[model samples]
Target: MEHPALHQAMLKSTFYPGEAGPVEFHETHISRLYLTHDHVYKLKKPVNFQFLDFTTLEKRHFYCNEELRLNQRLCSDTYLDVLEIRQDGDSFHLGAGSGEIIDYLLRMKRLPEGRMLSNLLTAADPTLPGEMERLGRHLAYWHRTQPPVGGDENADLERTRRNWDENLRQSAPLVENLLTADAQNRMREEVEHFLTEQAPLLRKRQSTGQVIDGHGDLHAEHICLTDPIRIYDCIEFNERFRLADRLADLAFLLMDLDYRGRRDLSAGVLQAYDETWGTDLDAPRLLRFYKSYRAWVRGKVLGFLAQDPEADAATRTDALARGRRYFSLALGYLCRRPSLILTCGLMGTGKSVLAAELATALGAIHLRSDELRKELAGLSPSSRDLSAFGEGLYHREATERTYRALADRAELHLAAGRTVIVDASFAEKGRRDDFRDLARRQQRPLAILWLNCPDELLLERLRQRRGDASDGRPELLAAQKRIFQPPCGESRVLPVDTRDEVAYNVQRIICHLANPEFLKEQP
Candidate 1:
């Protein structure tokens, strides 16, 4: 159906009434994008794929409304509303009209293209770090508030597994045509190994309620770093594609960073995420696996384009090269695992100082519970009321909630293949047990460094502390001392004296983490 009436309705719509000229319509493979000077309107293409359905006019209109509704959760200001295209005799008009409806479009306020993170990164702006870190905080906030999709864990895992398997199977034929026999065989073996190794972890993630409907496509191109750092163009067509393991969502950024040759920036983003969320044992492995998966998916997509009969020879060759590059990047992350070390102690114990140094030394994820707690509470660490020790701020219940939140975040990070340094008091036996269990479950090495000092020294340090990220007050320290449950017989604790120089204390923790067995009790 040509639907000229729908096109006329869209063009004459009052959605951008004050704009200077006629609205320009741009069509992508999947959607029709109408751009005015002040707004951008998108309508789903009337096409049905195995993964996406927008075959009928009604379906397209429903999804257009769905996009508007879902996107408003994050970018309420930008995603204005869905406008209706109404047919009047031979022509159509937008808005609530008394005529035959033909189509719908999700209207959004236009943003400056220059504000995109991808563009800023390309321009080599130094402010990119602060911008990305802010984005990390925004993402962390969104993840915390987003409702979980309730479903059978086994079914979800199987569904995800089948999707991944299908991607690999689809790409296998192309790989055969593109590579030498030896290379093809090697790639097949690697894919098989990856599937087998990651299957159980994927299951664990779903069963533990870690799978959620996340921004399906998270990459530099999709993220616009405007004032509020708007993340637009989320996958709205397919639930299966969008509902995913959280680690998979994070992997997009990691892969994008690597693709851009900014591993340092990637590291910083992960660190900021860890600080806001929590530490994880499987982070390094998960990062590698997800990065590989994202790269493979990209490679598979490029391979499809390469095989298109309409593609020019140059375009086909370029697509093939892109596929090969991503494939290599995936293999590189899979080849090695990084080491992780956790710093555990009470407030004013120099744990943060030590953790920061260790992170610099080992390029680890420096996760702090204080930062995460602040994030969860929807307050900054510097917020005066954060340490009030009352309802919703600081108390037994609040602390428990914070620790659980940290544990959840830690697990996600661990799954992404990053070494993590968890900076927390570990003041409770139960809390310590949780970390130990996480390490054991993930099959990753775990070490705990207990910073200790004389009461006088600790008191002095606490008193001298200026504006800090932690919520520990002198009064809270007194309470902590009273209730603190130190690591016991079963706990693996590496004790470090805080009275020593900062560098010396950090070095001691690093040495112990390098070889945890050295810190074990001598028989």
Candidate 2:
């Protein structure tokens, strides 16, 4: 296939030493790479996208050298050298041939196919968790050894802000089509607020040597899970991209893990990094700011690929899907705080189901009072010895202890940097108020989801229920109805009808959670 005016003949096995086979080709927005048996050669496309320019022969030559130099910092054994594609009368040869230089190529030893972290993750490899932890430690060592990038602090902050500005500008075309307009607006406002409020932290990091030259395009795809686990293909075209607060570099990988739905891996990586440095410094604001920005940048990059004219329809469709995911992730990062979601309703209203669903959707920790109460009473989760209200484990004093334990468990989860959902009937107003006080004391956002259903439907569901953690029965529904203090006049309370279609209910809940007002404190 002809690529960048290079014909198939130019990729003959004879062009390089110890290489044989038809070349494997890969193309990105700015470069085309050919992977031979032993080595890979990357050729810059002669296109000047405003952020990067490789249009001229000299510019390509410079970027090729720059790429070779920069990538060697992390994968020294992989990046070999930059070679010129010399031209003869009718053919092109790699390396120093007696012909005019037509183009330049960055040459490197080819990594094993399907060995990248991304591939392994996609294949659901069982060993990835340990490998990811090692990767985090590796990054920590690299950051510790590398000298920090020094320059004007104010200018650096502005440069970081411009990255977000550029992302919003590039993603504008996707509004109302690939991404929702409301999401875009909310993200923009939240990002701006974060950058402004956290400016001091950014400056402090720079002043304290926390800003370092680091791998800019750090994601699973660029990481080879070999013995040494080489991470290659750093940002070589722009120094500004490569030089930033070390946390920003780390956030890129975290964002990738989040995008891949690997919250466990992400947590492991962060924990390992913190342990390696022996620091318990809390940087949630910085983490969220950078993660949101990185996700948006990923979306913008995918959008560019989707819009590329040369991509096939199938490829474009896949890019669009991936782009939407990244944008959604960005929005999620924007709104994600260590918050509490209380699923409040009488029995058979599906509060537990809704809580579980929401927790899975947001990767939040789901805490069920039934399970907690059983565990507290030294009973198995499945063991059900039904007792009347105000007797045995259901006694007033025991129930109060159970609620306190639940709130304590929720707080622990929140402290560990996770959103939490507490599933309980919350029949008593005092219990609900206790949770509200807990949230206020912690300064954590709280949303109460009150489930509603017709009494007949509730009875029907209770009758059909086979196995559940809850002990509610039709006999107790009357007492629950009498004592249940449904959420009222609370701005953070979102009342949803469990009798409605599941999809509709889920959508409404998601929309409510995404609303900034829902995250605010209620009057």
Candidate 3:
């Protein structure tokens, strides 16, 4: 059944087991969760893929029960039951015994949000390392309880190879369009090299019977740092994903810790897992391989999310931001070389937001033209100048000065071997050309993210914009659109639509940076 309307109608607190209050809603590609004060009601989206299918009501119901069964092993008190969501004409009711059942909900008791492990990472708790150790031991003890999947190393190796091949096959469409095409080649090369060179190690781990029914998706967000840690949300829809070498499972969490820039905590987690699992073997290279594999899986998922048609603009953009970060993060464990980026588009297309997020991900500095223009004019960032498109403070000479200053600052940083992202409306080819020349002279790869959006949404955004440095308005859109250069036939330019069905904007920059040929070499 189509779930969008159902999702909207079920937002009222009447359907939940809580007192009347607002229901918090969240969505992933596979599921939609309704969080009340006491419990979270998770509804599976009807999605059919090669891995699993939840499109039919029977399948969703079975999987909902399967989820309760699998997760009960860890958090028995948390996974309450798989409840029927029945529909009577227009209204929907939770746990209804009558009426036509439309879908099933996995009912789970709410965990403390503040105590979630992801949130606690920033609290600077003195005992966090100890907590990580405790968490690791708990996972290891659980892994031991699970029946081993046996030690047929050849079959297991074949499965691993199959999974990797399927991932590449599924992700081929995203290459070069949403992700860096070169990353696909680089990632495959690395994995194949590991599989060939480390065949003995892979066989040994398999021979030791390390494979088990374990949590397939184990990241910080799924963990709680309570008195006894609670890890929920096991991948129940697919057995292949859930059954793996316990070390592969461990690799998921370790990779997450490393992604969080906490190798110390990763060490702690690994140490405890080793101590509890009765194995002193510490295979760093194997662990690193698994970590990269895990990162690629996550990055590939995010890239799919970047193309999801149902998600909103902000969600899509955020997916792009994370996809780029994750792919680049997995491409090399080392820091990337210096690069340059420019956010060039008309006003009200979300250039600043994308630029800022890109800056945070790439560890680059963001230079906004609007802010810099004001600074150059000796005015505060919020100072208003209601000038026409090409007059007053925004006149030709003034804009040239602002762009020149931006280029100079970017060049200075580039000379110091740092990455730079400049956020601006490059309406003129001459202005963009100046920056291209600067990047060429510096020999740093440069990309221009040209953001676009639906005209109606753009107009509405321009109209509603307030209390910001941007002077974009509905009135100025006609002028901006009429005069804006489209950056046609430019190898360094990537155009993006900002709303739902956006063209995966920021991730393309990562793709460009991953391949040197994507940059313009001409002076």
- Among these predicted structures, which one has the highest lDDT? 2
lDDT of 1 by residue, 431-451 (tens): 878877887666666777878
Global lDDT scores for all candidate models: 0.71, 0.80, 0.79
Say which prediction, candidate 1 or candidate 3, comes out ahead on TM-score.
Answer: 3
In the order shown, the candidates' Cα RMSDs to the true structure are 17.8, 6.4, 9.3
Q: For residues 154-249, could you state the per-residue lDDT of candidate 2 as single tens digits?
A: 656887988878789888987755666666677777778877887887787778888888989999989998888799999988887878888889
Report how far off residue 81 is in candidate 3 (Å). Answer: 1.0
The runs of at least 3 residues in candidate 2 whose Cα sits more than 4 Å from the true structure, single-residue gaps closed, are 1-5, 280-282, 342-361, 366-417, 421-517
Q: TM-score: which candidate is best?
A: 2
Candidate 2 positional error at 17, Å: 3.4
- Residue 248 in candidate 2, Cα distance off native in Å: 0.4
Q: What would the per-residue lDDT of candidate 3 be over residues 66-113, giving only the tens digit for each residue?
A: 999999988898999888888887777777677899889898889998
Candidate 3 — which residues are off by over 4 angstroms? Answer: 3-9, 17-20, 89-91, 122-126, 177-179, 280-282, 333-523
Ranking by TM-score: 2, 3, 1
Sort by lDDT, best first.
2, 3, 1
- How does each model score on TM-score? 0.61, 0.74, 0.63
**What's model 1's overall lDDT?**
0.71
